[model samples]
Target: MPPLRPELQAAHDEMDETGQDYAFAVCPTWQGDAWEVNTKEVNIYSALSGTFKSHAEATAAGTAWLLGV
Candidate 1:
């Protein structure tokens, strides 16, 4: 598996406090111009949709989704 990006690592750290089993990924768009956040355990939380302009935005969205904020 590829290493987690800094933004993702920070988001994961925040999510860890929620005490829930959540799995997600932040990936680059096909055009390599944006970021996308996808969750494996959508049943546990609302899926974060739409592409983000940067890794930070994607990470924030994922963190909010996992933390239910």
Candidate 2:
């Protein structure tokens, strides 16, 4: 996978219930007004839709969805 931005730290490096390894990170949108939660499972990468006002919010939401918490 490509490297994350210098200002951004890596997040979510745990396996889900099905034992699939995954990771997620909060990236700035193209417009730079909000954050998008980007996830990686196996070799596929995707971004979840949502408007997060801050990086922490995006990270929390992504973690919940990824872990099914």
- Tell me each candidate's TM-score: 0.57, 0.64
List clashing residue pairs in candidate 1: none
User: Alpha carbon lDDT of residue 52, candidate 1?
Assistant: 96
lDDT of 2 by residue, 20-61 (tens): 657676777767898878777876666777769998899898
lDDT tens digits, residues 1-69, model 1? 897656555545555555556756576766779987766463443336689999899888877776773
Every candidate's lDDT: 0.66, 0.68
Cα-lDDT of candidate 2: 0.68
TM-score of 1: 0.57
Clashing pairs in 2: none
